[model samples]
Target chain A: MEAFITYTLFAMLVATALAAVQLNRLFAVVMLSGVFSLLSAVLFVVLDAPDVAFTEAAVGAGISTVLMLGTLALTSRTEKSSSRSSAIPLLVVIVTGIVLVYGTLDMPNFGSANTPANTHIAAQFIEKTPHQIDVPNIVTAILASYRGYDTLGEVVVVFTAGIGVLLLIGRLGRRGERQKQIGRGE
Target chain B: MFVVAAIAVIVAMLLVLVRLYAGPTLYDRVLAVNVFGTHTVLLIGVVGFLTGRPDFLDIALLYALINFVGTIAVLKYFRYRAIGDVSASSVKREKAR
Candidate 1:
Protein backbone atom coordinates (compact mmCIF):
# COMPACT_ATOMS: atom_id res chain seq x y z
CA MET A 1 0.00 0.00 0.00
CA GLU A 2 2.77 2.36 0.93
CA ALA A 3 4.62 1.56 -2.26
CA PHE A 4 1.54 2.32 -4.30
CA ILE A 5 1.16 5.63 -2.52
CA THR A 6 4.80 6.55 -3.01
CA TYR A 7 4.69 5.71 -6.70
CA THR A 8 1.55 7.77 -7.16
CA LEU A 9 3.09 10.84 -5.49
CA PHE A 10 6.26 10.46 -7.52
CA ALA A 11 4.15 10.36 -10.66
CA MET A 12 2.28 13.49 -9.58
CA LEU A 13 5.52 15.35 -9.02
CA VAL A 14 6.75 14.42 -12.49
CA ALA A 15 3.48 15.37 -14.17
CA THR A 16 3.29 18.74 -12.44
CA ALA A 17 6.88 19.50 -13.30
CA LEU A 18 6.09 18.73 -16.93
CA ALA A 19 3.00 20.88 -16.76
CA ALA A 20 4.99 23.79 -15.36
CA VAL A 21 7.39 23.57 -18.27
CA GLN A 22 4.78 22.96 -20.95
CA LEU A 23 2.45 25.83 -20.12
CA ASN A 24 3.17 28.90 -22.22
CA ARG A 25 0.74 31.37 -20.78
CA LEU A 26 2.51 33.15 -17.95
CA PHE A 27 -0.51 32.86 -15.66
CA ALA A 28 -0.92 29.20 -16.44
CA VAL A 29 2.71 28.58 -15.87
CA VAL A 30 2.46 30.28 -12.52
CA MET A 31 -0.60 28.25 -11.60
CA LEU A 32 1.00 24.99 -12.66
CA SER A 33 3.94 25.97 -10.57
CA GLY A 34 1.52 26.18 -7.68
CA VAL A 35 0.38 22.66 -8.42
CA PHE A 36 3.97 21.53 -8.48
CA SER A 37 4.50 23.18 -5.10
CA LEU A 38 1.43 21.50 -3.60
CA LEU A 39 2.58 18.14 -4.83
CA SER A 40 5.95 18.74 -3.30
CA ALA A 41 4.22 19.62 -0.03
CA VAL A 42 2.36 16.33 -0.18
CA LEU A 43 5.59 14.51 -0.87
CA PHE A 44 7.04 16.14 2.21
CA VAL A 45 4.16 14.83 4.31
CA VAL A 46 4.56 11.35 2.88
CA LEU A 47 8.22 11.63 3.73
CA ASP A 48 7.36 12.55 7.34
CA ALA A 49 8.54 16.15 7.25
CA PRO A 50 5.28 17.84 8.10
CA ASP A 51 6.88 21.15 9.00
CA VAL A 52 8.70 21.31 5.70
CA ALA A 53 5.55 20.18 3.92
CA PHE A 54 3.57 23.02 5.46
CA THR A 55 6.23 25.54 4.56
CA GLU A 56 6.32 24.21 1.01
CA ALA A 57 2.56 24.45 0.64
CA ALA A 58 2.34 27.98 2.02
CA VAL A 59 5.32 29.59 0.34
CA GLY A 60 5.40 27.55 -2.83
CA ALA A 61 1.75 27.19 -3.74
CA GLY A 62 0.44 30.29 -2.08
CA ILE A 63 2.60 33.40 -1.95
CA SER A 64 4.88 32.52 -4.84
CA THR A 65 1.98 31.95 -7.23
CA VAL A 66 0.40 35.20 -6.11
CA LEU A 67 3.62 37.09 -6.76
CA MET A 68 4.11 35.44 -10.15
CA LEU A 69 0.57 36.16 -11.25
CA GLY A 70 0.90 39.75 -10.13
CA THR A 71 3.99 40.05 -12.27
CA LEU A 72 2.23 38.37 -15.18
CA ALA A 73 -0.69 40.80 -15.08
CA LEU A 74 1.73 43.67 -15.15
CA THR A 75 3.50 42.15 -18.15
CA SER A 76 2.67 40.26 -21.33
CA ARG A 77 0.51 37.16 -21.23
CA THR A 78 1.67 35.29 -24.31
CA GLU A 79 5.19 34.02 -24.11
CA LYS A 80 7.65 35.56 -26.54
CA SER A 81 8.79 32.89 -28.96
CA SER A 82 12.31 34.27 -28.87
CA SER A 83 12.42 33.79 -25.13
CA ARG A 84 11.68 30.05 -25.48
CA SER A 85 15.03 29.13 -26.90
CA SER A 86 16.54 25.88 -25.64
CA ALA A 87 20.02 27.37 -25.11
CA ILE A 88 21.46 28.10 -21.70
CA PRO A 89 18.48 27.33 -19.43
CA LEU A 90 18.19 23.81 -20.83
CA LEU A 91 21.84 23.13 -20.14
CA VAL A 92 21.47 24.47 -16.63
CA VAL A 93 18.34 22.39 -16.04
CA ILE A 94 20.06 19.23 -17.23
CA VAL A 95 23.09 19.83 -15.05
CA THR A 96 20.94 20.63 -12.02
CA GLY A 97 18.77 17.57 -12.58
CA ILE A 98 21.83 15.33 -12.70
CA VAL A 99 23.21 16.87 -9.56
CA LEU A 100 19.87 16.52 -7.74
CA VAL A 101 19.46 12.86 -8.78
CA TYR A 102 22.98 12.09 -7.68
CA GLY A 103 22.37 13.74 -4.32
CA THR A 104 19.20 11.66 -3.80
CA LEU A 105 21.11 8.44 -4.32
CA ASP A 106 22.61 8.65 -0.86
CA MET A 107 19.47 9.65 1.05
CA PRO A 108 17.78 7.34 3.50
CA ASN A 109 14.92 5.10 2.43
CA PHE A 110 11.39 6.49 2.63
CA GLY A 111 9.39 5.84 5.83
CA SER A 112 12.29 4.26 7.60
CA ALA A 113 11.65 4.90 11.28
CA ASN A 114 15.32 4.46 12.06
CA THR A 115 16.69 6.93 9.51
CA PRO A 116 19.29 9.39 10.72
CA ALA A 117 16.82 12.27 10.40
CA ASN A 118 14.26 10.52 12.54
CA THR A 119 16.86 9.63 15.16
CA HIS A 120 18.59 12.91 15.69
CA ILE A 121 16.75 16.16 16.52
CA ALA A 122 13.42 14.66 15.63
CA ALA A 123 13.75 11.93 18.25
CA GLN A 124 14.82 14.43 20.82
CA PHE A 125 11.87 16.62 20.07
CA ILE A 126 9.41 13.77 19.99
CA GLU A 127 10.62 12.43 23.28
CA LYS A 128 11.18 15.64 25.17
CA THR A 129 8.64 18.06 23.69
CA PRO A 130 5.54 16.61 25.33
CA HIS A 131 7.01 17.11 28.76
CA GLN A 132 8.25 20.57 27.96
CA ILE A 133 5.43 22.18 26.04
CA ASP A 134 2.39 20.18 27.05
CA VAL A 135 1.38 20.13 23.38
CA PRO A 136 0.11 17.05 21.62
CA ASN A 137 1.85 18.06 18.42
CA ILE A 138 5.58 17.87 18.90
CA VAL A 139 6.25 19.42 15.54
CA THR A 140 4.37 22.50 16.65
CA ALA A 141 6.43 22.76 19.75
CA ILE A 142 9.58 22.47 17.74
CA LEU A 143 8.53 25.09 15.24
CA ALA A 144 7.26 27.59 17.78
CA SER A 145 10.16 27.01 20.16
CA TYR A 146 13.00 24.72 19.19
CA ARG A 147 13.59 26.59 15.94
CA GLY A 148 11.64 29.69 16.78
CA TYR A 149 14.24 32.05 15.41
CA ASP A 150 14.01 30.57 11.92
CA THR A 151 10.26 30.91 11.98
CA LEU A 152 10.59 34.49 13.13
CA GLY A 153 12.93 35.14 10.24
CA GLU A 154 10.40 33.62 7.87
CA VAL A 155 7.68 35.92 9.17
CA VAL A 156 9.93 38.94 8.74
CA VAL A 157 10.74 37.87 5.23
CA VAL A 158 7.06 37.59 4.39
CA PHE A 159 6.45 41.01 5.87
CA THR A 160 9.21 42.43 3.72
CA ALA A 161 7.71 40.88 0.59
CA GLY A 162 4.34 42.38 1.40
CA ILE A 163 5.95 45.77 1.82
CA GLY A 164 7.84 45.38 -1.44
CA VAL A 165 4.74 44.44 -3.40
CA LEU A 166 2.83 47.29 -1.86
CA LEU A 167 5.55 49.72 -2.86
CA LEU A 168 5.61 48.38 -6.40
CA ILE A 169 1.89 48.44 -6.91
CA GLY A 170 1.50 51.69 -5.06
CA ARG A 171 4.03 53.38 -7.33
CA LEU A 172 2.22 52.09 -10.37
CA GLY A 173 -0.96 53.58 -8.98
CA ARG A 174 0.53 57.04 -8.86
CA ARG A 175 2.28 57.34 -12.22
CA GLY A 176 -0.66 58.18 -14.46
CA GLU A 177 -1.57 61.69 -15.68
CA ARG A 178 -4.71 61.68 -13.50
CA GLN A 179 -2.57 60.97 -10.50
CA LYS A 180 -0.33 63.78 -11.48
CA GLN A 181 -3.33 66.09 -11.80
CA ILE A 182 -4.51 65.12 -8.33
CA GLY A 183 -1.05 65.67 -7.02
CA ARG A 184 -0.84 69.10 -8.65
CA GLY A 185 -4.34 70.12 -7.54
CA GLU A 186 -3.73 68.98 -3.97
CA MET B 1 -5.99 6.43 -0.40
CA PHE B 2 -3.88 9.52 0.00
CA VAL B 3 -1.47 8.39 -2.68
CA VAL B 4 -4.26 7.63 -5.10
CA ALA B 5 -5.70 11.04 -4.56
CA ALA B 6 -2.30 12.58 -5.03
CA ILE B 7 -1.97 10.85 -8.41
CA ALA B 8 -5.38 12.07 -9.44
CA VAL B 9 -4.56 15.62 -8.48
CA ILE B 10 -1.27 15.47 -10.34
CA VAL B 11 -2.98 14.20 -13.47
CA ALA B 12 -5.46 17.01 -13.18
CA MET B 13 -2.60 19.44 -12.78
CA LEU B 14 -0.99 18.13 -15.96
CA LEU B 15 -4.23 18.57 -17.86
CA VAL B 16 -4.51 22.09 -16.49
CA LEU B 17 -0.98 22.78 -17.67
CA VAL B 18 -1.97 21.76 -21.17
CA ARG B 19 -4.83 24.20 -20.96
CA LEU B 20 -2.40 26.86 -19.82
CA TYR B 21 -0.18 26.13 -22.75
CA ALA B 22 -3.09 26.46 -25.16
CA GLY B 23 -4.59 29.51 -23.49
CA PRO B 24 -5.69 32.07 -26.04
CA THR B 25 -6.03 34.78 -23.42
CA LEU B 26 -4.42 35.89 -20.17
CA TYR B 27 -7.62 35.39 -18.19
CA ASP B 28 -7.72 31.73 -19.07
CA ARG B 29 -4.20 31.30 -17.81
CA VAL B 30 -5.02 33.14 -14.59
CA LEU B 31 -8.03 30.92 -14.03
CA ALA B 32 -5.96 27.81 -14.53
CA VAL B 33 -3.39 29.09 -12.04
CA ASN B 34 -6.09 29.88 -9.49
CA VAL B 35 -7.35 26.35 -9.75
CA PHE B 36 -3.83 25.02 -9.38
CA GLY B 37 -3.32 27.11 -6.25
CA THR B 38 -6.42 25.72 -4.53
CA HIS B 39 -5.39 22.17 -5.29
CA THR B 40 -2.01 22.84 -3.76
CA VAL B 41 -3.53 24.02 -0.50
CA LEU B 42 -5.37 20.73 -0.18
CA LEU B 43 -2.29 18.79 -1.16
CA ILE B 44 -0.32 20.34 1.65
CA GLY B 45 -2.92 19.42 4.22
CA VAL B 46 -3.00 15.86 2.94
CA VAL B 47 0.76 15.66 3.03
CA GLY B 48 0.77 16.78 6.64
CA PHE B 49 -1.58 13.97 7.49
CA LEU B 50 0.46 11.41 5.62
CA THR B 51 3.57 12.44 7.46
CA GLY B 52 2.05 12.55 10.95
CA ARG B 53 2.85 16.21 11.31
CA PRO B 54 -0.16 18.37 11.96
CA ASP B 55 1.82 21.51 12.59
CA PHE B 56 1.89 21.98 8.85
CA LEU B 57 -1.68 23.18 9.07
CA ASP B 58 -0.46 26.62 10.07
CA ILE B 59 1.51 26.89 6.86
CA ALA B 60 -1.43 25.69 4.80
CA LEU B 61 -3.61 28.37 6.35
CA LEU B 62 -1.04 30.99 5.53
CA TYR B 63 -0.90 29.79 1.91
CA ALA B 64 -4.65 30.02 1.56
CA LEU B 65 -4.71 33.59 2.81
CA ILE B 66 -1.84 34.70 0.62
CA ASN B 67 -3.16 33.04 -2.54
CA PHE B 68 -6.51 34.77 -2.23
CA VAL B 69 -4.91 38.12 -1.58
CA GLY B 70 -2.57 37.70 -4.54
CA THR B 71 -5.28 36.75 -7.03
CA ILE B 72 -7.41 39.72 -6.03
CA ALA B 73 -4.44 42.02 -6.24
CA VAL B 74 -3.54 40.85 -9.73
CA LEU B 75 -7.09 41.22 -10.98
CA LYS B 76 -7.32 44.66 -9.43
CA TYR B 77 -4.03 45.72 -10.95
CA PHE B 78 -5.22 44.70 -14.40
CA ARG B 79 -8.46 46.56 -13.94
CA TYR B 80 -6.61 49.58 -12.70
CA ARG B 81 -4.30 49.50 -15.67
CA ALA B 82 -7.21 49.20 -18.01
CA ILE B 83 -8.83 52.16 -16.32
CA GLY B 84 -5.61 54.13 -16.43
CA ASP B 85 -5.25 53.43 -20.13
CA VAL B 86 -8.78 54.63 -20.83
CA SER B 87 -8.41 57.75 -18.75
CA ALA B 88 -5.05 58.58 -20.24
CA SER B 89 -6.59 59.35 -23.62
CA SER B 90 -10.00 60.61 -22.41
CA VAL B 91 -8.56 63.89 -21.02
CA LYS B 92 -11.44 64.38 -18.50
CA ARG B 93 -13.51 66.61 -20.73
CA GLU B 94 -15.07 69.21 -18.37
CA LYS B 95 -15.31 72.94 -17.87
CA ALA B 96 -15.20 72.88 -14.04
CA ARG B 97 -12.69 75.30 -12.40
Candidate 2:
Protein backbone atom coordinates (compact mmCIF):
# COMPACT_ATOMS: atom_id res chain seq x y z
CA MET A 1 0.00 0.00 0.00
CA GLU A 2 2.72 2.40 1.00
CA ALA A 3 4.70 1.48 -2.08
CA PHE A 4 1.70 2.19 -4.28
CA ILE A 5 1.20 5.60 -2.73
CA THR A 6 4.89 6.44 -2.95
CA TYR A 7 5.20 5.44 -6.58
CA THR A 8 2.11 7.33 -7.64
CA LEU A 9 3.20 10.55 -5.95
CA PHE A 10 6.73 10.26 -7.26
CA ALA A 11 5.51 9.74 -10.82
CA MET A 12 3.21 12.75 -10.66
CA LEU A 13 6.00 14.84 -9.15
CA VAL A 14 8.35 13.97 -12.00
CA ALA A 15 5.69 14.69 -14.59
CA THR A 16 4.92 18.10 -13.08
CA ALA A 17 8.61 19.00 -12.85
CA LEU A 18 9.22 18.04 -16.47
CA ALA A 19 6.19 20.00 -17.58
CA ALA A 20 7.41 23.01 -15.65
CA VAL A 21 10.77 22.74 -17.37
CA GLN A 22 9.24 22.60 -20.86
CA LEU A 23 6.72 25.40 -20.38
CA ASN A 24 7.23 28.85 -21.97
CA ARG A 25 4.62 30.71 -19.93
CA LEU A 26 6.18 32.06 -16.79
CA PHE A 27 2.84 32.11 -14.93
CA ALA A 28 2.19 28.47 -15.69
CA VAL A 29 5.72 27.62 -14.67
CA VAL A 30 5.34 29.38 -11.34
CA MET A 31 2.05 27.63 -10.64
CA LEU A 32 3.52 24.27 -11.61
CA SER A 33 6.41 24.93 -9.23
CA GLY A 34 3.88 25.40 -6.45
CA VAL A 35 2.26 22.12 -7.45
CA PHE A 36 5.67 20.47 -7.40
CA SER A 37 6.27 21.66 -3.85
CA LEU A 38 2.91 20.40 -2.59
CA LEU A 39 3.49 16.98 -4.12
CA SER A 40 6.87 16.75 -2.41
CA ALA A 41 5.27 17.69 0.87
CA VAL A 42 2.87 14.80 0.47
CA LEU A 43 5.79 12.55 -0.37
CA PHE A 44 7.54 13.72 2.79
CA VAL A 45 4.49 12.82 4.88
CA VAL A 46 4.27 9.41 3.21
CA LEU A 47 7.94 8.91 4.14
CA ASP A 48 7.09 9.65 7.80
CA ALA A 49 8.75 13.05 7.94
CA PRO A 50 5.82 15.26 8.86
CA ASP A 51 7.96 18.09 10.17
CA VAL A 52 9.84 18.32 6.90
CA ALA A 53 6.57 18.02 5.05
CA PHE A 54 5.12 20.86 7.07
CA THR A 55 8.06 23.11 6.32
CA GLU A 56 7.93 22.23 2.65
CA ALA A 57 4.19 22.86 2.49
CA ALA A 58 4.51 26.24 4.16
CA VAL A 59 7.72 27.48 2.59
CA GLY A 60 7.48 25.83 -0.80
CA ALA A 61 3.79 26.07 -1.59
CA GLY A 62 3.13 29.22 0.40
CA ILE A 63 5.95 31.76 0.69
CA SER A 64 7.77 30.81 -2.52
CA THR A 65 4.62 31.16 -4.60
CA VAL A 66 4.00 34.63 -3.20
CA LEU A 67 7.62 35.60 -3.76
CA MET A 68 7.54 34.30 -7.33
CA LEU A 69 4.40 36.26 -8.10
CA GLY A 70 6.08 39.35 -6.72
CA THR A 71 8.97 38.72 -9.07
CA LEU A 72 6.57 38.17 -11.95
CA ALA A 73 5.01 41.56 -11.27
CA LEU A 74 8.42 43.09 -11.94
CA THR A 75 9.10 40.98 -15.01
CA SER A 76 7.51 39.58 -18.13
CA ARG A 77 4.55 37.21 -17.88
CA THR A 78 5.82 34.83 -20.54
CA GLU A 79 9.31 33.50 -20.95
CA LYS A 80 11.43 35.35 -23.51
CA SER A 81 12.15 32.80 -26.17
CA SER A 82 15.78 32.46 -27.14
CA SER A 83 16.89 31.22 -30.53
CA ARG A 84 19.30 28.73 -28.98
CA SER A 85 18.18 25.15 -28.51
CA SER A 86 17.80 23.80 -24.93
CA ALA A 87 20.18 20.94 -25.68
CA ILE A 88 22.98 21.94 -23.29
CA PRO A 89 20.68 22.56 -20.32
CA LEU A 90 18.87 19.32 -21.08
CA LEU A 91 22.18 17.45 -21.13
CA VAL A 92 23.20 18.95 -17.80
CA VAL A 93 19.86 17.98 -16.25
CA ILE A 94 20.09 14.41 -17.55
CA VAL A 95 23.62 14.02 -16.20
CA THR A 96 22.63 15.40 -12.80
CA GLY A 97 19.58 13.19 -12.66
CA ILE A 98 21.65 10.11 -13.45
CA VAL A 99 24.15 10.95 -10.70
CA LEU A 100 21.40 11.54 -8.15
CA VAL A 101 19.69 8.25 -9.04
CA TYR A 102 22.99 6.45 -8.71
CA GLY A 103 23.57 8.00 -5.29
CA THR A 104 20.13 6.92 -4.06
CA LEU A 105 20.80 3.27 -4.93
CA ASP A 106 22.89 2.80 -1.78
CA MET A 107 20.39 4.42 0.59
CA PRO A 108 18.31 2.22 2.87
CA ASN A 109 14.68 1.60 2.03
CA PHE A 110 12.34 4.23 3.37
CA GLY A 111 10.81 3.49 6.82
CA SER A 112 13.02 0.46 7.40
CA ALA A 113 13.43 -0.15 11.12
CA ASN A 114 17.20 -0.53 11.11
CA THR A 115 18.09 2.08 8.53
CA PRO A 116 20.88 4.40 9.61
CA ALA A 117 18.40 7.23 9.83
CA ASN A 118 16.25 5.22 12.21
CA THR A 119 19.06 3.61 14.20
CA HIS A 120 21.67 6.30 14.47
CA ILE A 121 21.33 9.53 16.44
CA ALA A 122 17.65 9.34 15.57
CA ALA A 123 17.18 6.56 18.12
CA GLN A 124 18.93 8.50 20.84
CA PHE A 125 16.93 11.64 20.10
CA ILE A 126 13.67 9.70 19.95
CA GLU A 127 14.60 7.88 23.14
CA LYS A 128 15.62 10.92 25.15
CA THR A 129 13.05 13.37 23.76
CA PRO A 130 10.18 11.90 25.75
CA HIS A 131 11.96 12.57 29.02
CA GLN A 132 14.15 15.53 28.21
CA ILE A 133 11.63 17.69 26.41
CA ASP A 134 8.40 16.05 27.54
CA VAL A 135 6.85 16.86 24.18
CA PRO A 136 4.51 14.43 22.54
CA ASN A 137 5.94 15.30 19.16
CA ILE A 138 9.61 14.42 19.14
CA VAL A 139 10.18 16.24 15.84
CA THR A 140 8.96 19.50 17.29
CA ALA A 141 10.86 18.91 20.52
CA ILE A 142 14.10 18.31 18.68
CA LEU A 143 13.62 21.25 16.36
CA ALA A 144 12.36 23.81 18.89
CA SER A 145 14.50 22.89 21.89
CA TYR A 146 17.29 20.46 21.17
CA ARG A 147 18.32 22.32 18.04
CA GLY A 148 17.49 25.79 19.24
CA TYR A 149 20.60 27.37 17.79
CA ASP A 150 19.96 26.01 14.30
CA THR A 151 16.37 27.21 14.37
CA LEU A 152 17.55 30.63 15.56
CA GLY A 153 19.96 30.78 12.66
CA GLU A 154 17.16 29.95 10.26
CA VAL A 155 15.07 32.75 11.75
CA VAL A 156 17.96 35.17 11.32
CA VAL A 157 18.29 34.20 7.67
CA VAL A 158 14.59 34.80 7.10
CA PHE A 159 14.82 38.17 8.86
CA THR A 160 17.68 39.18 6.62
CA ALA A 161 15.63 38.17 3.59
CA GLY A 162 12.69 40.30 4.73
CA ILE A 163 14.96 43.32 5.20
CA GLY A 164 16.58 42.78 1.84
CA VAL A 165 13.24 42.53 0.04
CA LEU A 166 11.94 45.69 1.70
CA LEU A 167 15.09 47.58 0.78
CA LEU A 168 14.99 46.41 -2.83
CA ILE A 169 11.30 47.11 -3.32
CA GLY A 170 11.35 50.33 -1.34
CA ARG A 171 7.84 49.49 -0.16
CA LEU A 172 7.48 52.66 1.85
CA GLY A 173 7.92 54.92 -1.19
CA ARG A 174 6.71 52.92 -4.18
CA ARG A 175 3.97 50.96 -2.45
CA GLY A 176 2.67 54.02 -0.66
CA GLU A 177 2.40 55.97 -3.89
CA ARG A 178 0.72 53.06 -5.63
CA GLN A 179 -1.71 52.71 -2.76
CA LYS A 180 -2.64 56.38 -3.01
CA GLN A 181 -3.22 56.14 -6.75
CA ILE A 182 -5.30 53.02 -6.28
CA GLY A 183 -7.31 54.77 -3.62
CA ARG A 184 -8.00 57.62 -6.05
CA GLY A 185 -8.81 55.19 -8.87
CA GLU A 186 -11.94 54.16 -7.04
CA MET B 1 -7.89 2.86 3.49
CA PHE B 2 -5.32 5.58 4.03
CA VAL B 3 -3.33 4.24 1.14
CA VAL B 4 -6.33 4.30 -1.14
CA ALA B 5 -7.13 7.85 -0.06
CA ALA B 6 -3.58 8.94 -0.69
CA ILE B 7 -3.68 7.37 -4.11
CA ALA B 8 -6.88 9.20 -4.91
CA VAL B 9 -5.39 12.52 -3.87
CA ILE B 10 -2.30 11.88 -5.95
CA VAL B 11 -4.39 11.05 -9.00
CA ALA B 12 -6.29 14.28 -8.56
CA MET B 13 -3.01 16.11 -8.23
CA LEU B 14 -1.82 14.65 -11.50
CA LEU B 15 -4.94 15.86 -13.26
CA VAL B 16 -4.40 19.35 -11.82
CA LEU B 17 -0.81 19.29 -13.01
CA VAL B 18 -1.99 18.62 -16.55
CA ARG B 19 -4.13 21.74 -16.55
CA LEU B 20 -1.37 23.76 -14.93
CA TYR B 21 1.06 22.80 -17.67
CA ALA B 22 -1.35 23.41 -20.57
CA GLY B 23 -2.71 26.67 -19.32
CA PRO B 24 -4.26 28.91 -21.99
CA THR B 25 -4.72 31.61 -19.37
CA LEU B 26 -3.00 32.70 -16.17
CA TYR B 27 -6.16 32.03 -14.17
CA ASP B 28 -6.07 28.37 -15.07
CA ARG B 29 -2.63 27.91 -13.52
CA VAL B 30 -3.62 29.84 -10.42
CA LEU B 31 -6.70 27.70 -10.07
CA ALA B 32 -4.61 24.59 -10.46
CA VAL B 33 -2.29 25.74 -7.70
CA ASN B 34 -5.21 26.38 -5.38
CA VAL B 35 -6.61 22.93 -6.00
CA PHE B 36 -3.20 21.36 -5.50
CA GLY B 37 -2.83 23.10 -2.15
CA THR B 38 -6.14 21.67 -0.97
CA HIS B 39 -5.04 18.18 -1.99
CA THR B 40 -1.80 18.53 -0.08
CA VAL B 41 -3.71 19.40 3.08
CA LEU B 42 -5.90 16.32 2.70
CA LEU B 43 -2.94 14.11 1.90
CA ILE B 44 -1.09 15.31 4.98
CA GLY B 45 -4.08 14.68 7.25
CA VAL B 46 -4.67 11.19 5.88
CA VAL B 47 -1.01 10.24 5.95
CA GLY B 48 -0.68 11.44 9.52
CA PHE B 49 -3.56 9.25 10.60
CA LEU B 50 -2.11 6.25 8.81
CA THR B 51 1.21 6.72 10.63
CA GLY B 52 -0.55 7.16 14.01
CA ARG B 53 0.95 10.59 14.42
CA PRO B 54 -1.92 12.93 15.09
CA ASP B 55 0.51 15.64 16.10
CA PHE B 56 1.00 16.39 12.44
CA LEU B 57 -2.44 17.94 12.36
CA ASP B 58 -0.90 21.17 13.59
CA ILE B 59 1.31 21.22 10.56
CA ALA B 60 -1.63 20.55 8.29
CA LEU B 61 -3.45 23.49 9.87
CA LEU B 62 -0.44 25.67 9.32
CA TYR B 63 -0.39 24.63 5.67
CA ALA B 64 -4.04 25.56 5.35
CA LEU B 65 -3.41 29.08 6.65
CA ILE B 66 -0.33 29.56 4.55
CA ASN B 67 -2.09 28.32 1.46
CA PHE B 68 -4.90 30.78 1.96
CA VAL B 69 -2.51 33.66 2.38
CA GLY B 70 -0.48 32.57 -0.65
CA THR B 71 -3.46 32.37 -3.01
CA ILE B 72 -4.68 35.77 -1.85
CA ALA B 73 -1.26 37.29 -2.29
CA VAL B 74 -0.87 35.89 -5.77
CA LEU B 75 -4.28 37.11 -6.88
CA LYS B 76 -3.64 40.50 -5.35
CA TYR B 77 -0.29 40.82 -7.06
CA PHE B 78 -1.80 39.86 -10.38
CA ARG B 79 -4.56 42.42 -10.10
CA TYR B 80 -2.80 45.33 -8.41
CA ARG B 81 0.83 44.54 -9.28
CA ALA B 82 1.39 44.81 -5.56
CA ILE B 83 0.29 42.74 -2.58
CA GLY B 84 0.48 45.57 -0.06
CA ASP B 85 -2.41 47.46 -1.63
CA VAL B 86 -4.96 44.66 -1.40
CA SER B 87 -6.90 46.34 1.37
CA ALA B 88 -6.72 49.80 -0.13
CA SER B 89 -7.86 48.62 -3.54
CA SER B 90 -10.69 46.54 -2.16
CA VAL B 91 -11.87 49.48 -0.11
CA LYS B 92 -11.80 51.74 -3.15
CA ARG B 93 -13.73 49.20 -5.20
CA GLU B 94 -16.38 49.00 -2.52
CA LYS B 95 -16.68 52.79 -2.44
CA ALA B 96 -16.91 52.97 -6.20
CA ARG B 97 -19.68 50.40 -6.21
Highest DockQ among the candidates is held by which one? Answer: 2
Q: TM-score for all predictions?
A: 0.62, 0.76
- lDDT tens digits, residue span A1-186, model 2: 667778888988889888887888888888888888888887887787877887788888887887887777766788887999989998998999999999999998765788877778888997888889999998789889999999999999999998998897666457756877898794
- TM value for model 2: 0.76
Model 2: residues >4 Å from true position, as ranges? A126-186, B1-5, B49-55, B86-97
Error of 2 at A145 (Å): 7.5
For model 2 chain A, where is the 10-residue window of minimal lDDT?
A168-177
Model 1, range A50-169, lDDT digits (tens) per residue? Answer: 668767766776667666755664568768777467888889989999999999999887668788787797778778888988989876887898889999998999899889988987
Docking class of predicted structure 1: acceptable
**Candidate 1 runs further than 4 Å off:** A5-9, A22-24, A45-53, A80-86, A130-137, A152-173, A176-186, B1-17, B25-97
Per-candidate local distance difference test? 0.68, 0.81
Q: Could you give candidate 2's per-residue lDDT for residues B1-97 as a string of tens digits?
A: 8778877877887788777877778888788888888887887788777767767777778877877888888887766676554566456775686
